[model samples]
Target chain A: MSLKSNVIGALILAGCASLYGCAGQHSEAALQQAGADFQKVKEDSNVLRIAPKDVIRAGESLARADRLSTYWGSGSDVVHYAYLSQRYSEIAREHTTQALNEERAAKLELERQRLQLALRESKLLSVQQQGKWLEEQIVALATTQTDRGLVMTLGDVLFDTGEAELKNSANRVVLKIVQFLQLNPKRVVRIEGYTDSTGGKQENLKLSRDRAQAVADVLMDLGIEDKRIQVEGYGDEYPVDANASERGRAQNRRVEIVFSDEKGQLGAAR
Target chain B: MAVLALAGCASDPAPNEQFRLTEQALEQAKAVGATADEVPEMKLAEGKFNRAKGNMADQSFKNARMRAEQAELDARLAEAKVLTQKSEEQVNVLNTRIVRLRKQLGDAQ
Candidate 1:
């Protein structure tokens, strides 16, 4: 009976030993993997610089796992510490990547600011050069110096038929006016709109007003002050030519800009 | 040997603080827009934290502590990844602005 008990005890011990062996092999693989991860982060310069604390924690956990692996039945403990070590290493890598991206963003922000300043300076230079050339064009465009101040006409072609929207073809003249106003900050202008005798008087009045306001809007958009512009609509009045022919109608349909003198004293509205 | 193992078990205090820390990490990860459905690390963190809670209830202090420690780091990694993605987007925005500025400068010249 004693010998039978001894045989049974030995069988149980063998089973326990094999079970421990399997756990040990599993934990050994985990420990090796964790060690590899730790090694990679430790050697990385950016990870070391950006995530030193995480790297240290990873090393500590790896050491704990390495120590635990030496114990006979501490397989689970070894694996757990190894897992923690791997996580710390992974966190370190992620932290390093985040820090690097932030660093790149900072540099790019400075570059963007520098580019913005450069663009503004370039625009200023170009505008200064165009100012001299546009001055000559303005003198030529001033068709008459009537009692209504120095009047310059923007033709009907600058707008769509019966529409208030100014076409893109008007950009040059608009820019020239904006530059002229900028050069003479004290001077103001009155924009007067007229249409040919085609639509109803009320419709002509609204369209003419809308067209005049459109030009004022573009001038304001280009940094001119709203107080510097006065807008008016004459409907079918203030015709420069008769409405008997298409060419006469075209001449009659126009928006005229009346600039004040150098003293900013605008003329009385018609 | 069995007595020594019992002594080790007796000496292990409950990982109440570690559990609190793990939960806080998980909350921070979520605050940074790290969702378990999106970030794999967040999924691991949530799963491990849940299992660690179960371990704590079962009075398995050692298992609970180990799992909580891993979960905390996993959540932190998730948060870092989300922050990194945001920073990458910021970089891209700056890149696009820079490209536009370059084009405008080219046109101006």
Candidate 2:
């Protein structure tokens, strides 16, 4: 019975020796691979900076694996420690990458906010410049200052002949006038209309009054107070040119914006 | 006394705390959008966690502890990867907005 037990023990030992022989070779490759992985992560400055504890753990696991590799019939333990070392190295790299990405995102977010603020300031400046340009255009249009006041003419081209409705072609001039009025808030204006001698006196009077009223209505629609405007009609009485020629008659048919003084005192109607 | 010491050395206590910790790590990974379908580390984590649970049931405390520890790290790696990807997307979004703002400022000038 003792001889039989010894034979059985020897057979089991032989089987384990063969199994360990195969496992030893496999674990050697695993250890080398884990060591290479750990070395890569350890050498990376970013990994070391961001995940120092994880790097240390990887080194410890690699050391344990190296110690176990020297033991007989302990191939699985060596492999396990090697795998843990590799995992630690991979995790360290992942943590480093995440930290770096977060840092980049924070910087990008700051840059985005700064650019947005700059764009808003630039847009506001452009609007202010545009307001100044419109003021210049209004001043140029009102260059004609007669005995009546600062007279800005709305020519016949702004409306169809005999039509009181202002045409879309007058939008630019109307917008400029609105802006000018808004800037000079205390100033008032008298809108005077005139017609040529071709029409009957009563009909010409009504048409001229309607045309002047149309301009006042536009000013009010554009947010100018109605109390700041005065409308008048002088039909066929005030002719700037002779009615014998079509060109002179065309010039005679007009609406004029007469600006008040800075103190809101407007000139008396003609 | 000798028999008791021999028995103590022969078997390990149950790794209940390690199991809890590993499960928490897996939950954290999932919360951050890490999925086995996308991240191989998540797959490894889940597989190892399941094997650890089986080892626990079989009273293999040593194997259970080892698997649970590895699984925890795997889950942590997966979570980190997903967070990094999200941060990368945020940086890209910020870059696009900055570019648009720059173009608008240039046009304004």
Candidate 3:
């Protein structure tokens, strides 16, 4: 070829290279958009903290897209890389969301367990307080704890001779016992009445029965349910003292109240 | 003369089947929420699909086939992204429920 033709060919080659450079410049807008998307993802604190690796991958993909668009003018390749960059950013967001949700669930589970434990502890404390209160009330009534149950004895003076009506002075002790029964609704009681040896056996038995029934009536009127009380008249049986002296005979004539077991079942008959 | 005319028709092979397949894939992706969460991938797929249709209109069978194939891949990627996003949302909802239950229990206590 001649020098002129060679020079002309060189000029044509340069012109083609410049035209390719112009085509490369056309991808600038797409590159800018990809860069903006990647920057937005990187700026998200959650993505940065929880999905740093994914964010880095997105940044790398965006850089590759920018390079392909600016240097090679590879339109198809640039678009593919940009799409990949966007997908990576979305993946980073998904991972960050998952991490945050898992953390929250774990915290909630811990809180639930703590609340359950606290509730159980509080219930136990309440039960213990109730038990202590019941014990204090029983002690205040001057009752005796026995194998059968708690027992309180009312002397013969609580009633007029041969009459079943309770005296006014006995009302305070009966009211206290009723209060205790109300507090422990699950407990039942058995009331027993006794008489001295002076009366006929049948009459003594009838009198004892009347007195026991009267005490039960008073308890029922005070709000204790009828089903929770059992009455028995011993009729001079199981006397606590000899009947020879007046004081001993008085001791023999008494009314006794016995509390029941936890299941509300009264113990064996005396 | 008739043979020559037939030959001319054969030279311009239409990419009807490939175009239809790409369109179906795009529709499937959109039905699965690709349009909302996977916007970038869905847009890329749509752009490639439209370009493929343009190539088909110009009777450029080779270019049309290449673009249709790329579009299908992009659509499939978008569908996968939608699936991932749905699972992530479910996890978030479950976490919120657990938190609410815990709060209720605490308040009751």
Candidate 2 has an interface RMSD (Å) of: 4.3
Model 3 C-alpha lDDT per residue in residues B34-90, reported as the tens digit of each score:
883447878888998889888888776756766886686578667756766666666
Best by lDDT: 1
Better of 1 and 2 by DockQ: 1
* Residue A12 shift from truth in candidate 2, angstroms: 25
Which segments of model 2 are wrong by more than 4 Å?
A1-23, A109-125, A143-152, A160-164, A175-270, B1-10, B97-109
Instruction: Give the distance in Å from residue A43's predicted Cα in candidate 2 to where it truly belongs.
Output: 2.3
The total of clashing pairs for model 3 equals 0
Question: Which regions of candidate 3 are displaced past 4 Å?
Answer: A1-30, A39-64, A67-80, A138-147, A152-257, A260-267, B1-109
Clashing pairs in 1: none
DockQ of 1: 0.57
Higher-ranked by DockQ: 2 or 3: 2
Best by DockQ: 1
Give the per-residue lDDT digits (tens) of candidate 2, residues A146-229. Answer: 787778999889989889999998889888888877877888999988899997999999888999999999999999999999
Q: DockQ numbers for every candidate?
A: 0.57, 0.44, 0.13
Error of 3 at A238 (Å): 7.3
**Per-residue lDDT for A267 in model 2?**
81
lDDT for each residue of candidate 3 in A74-111, tens digit (9 for 90 to 100):
55556656666766776677667667766766666676
Residue-wise C-alpha lDDT for candidate 1, range A58-119, written one tens digit per residue: 88887777666655677678788888888889889988888998999999999999999999
Sort candidate 2 into its docking category. Answer: acceptable
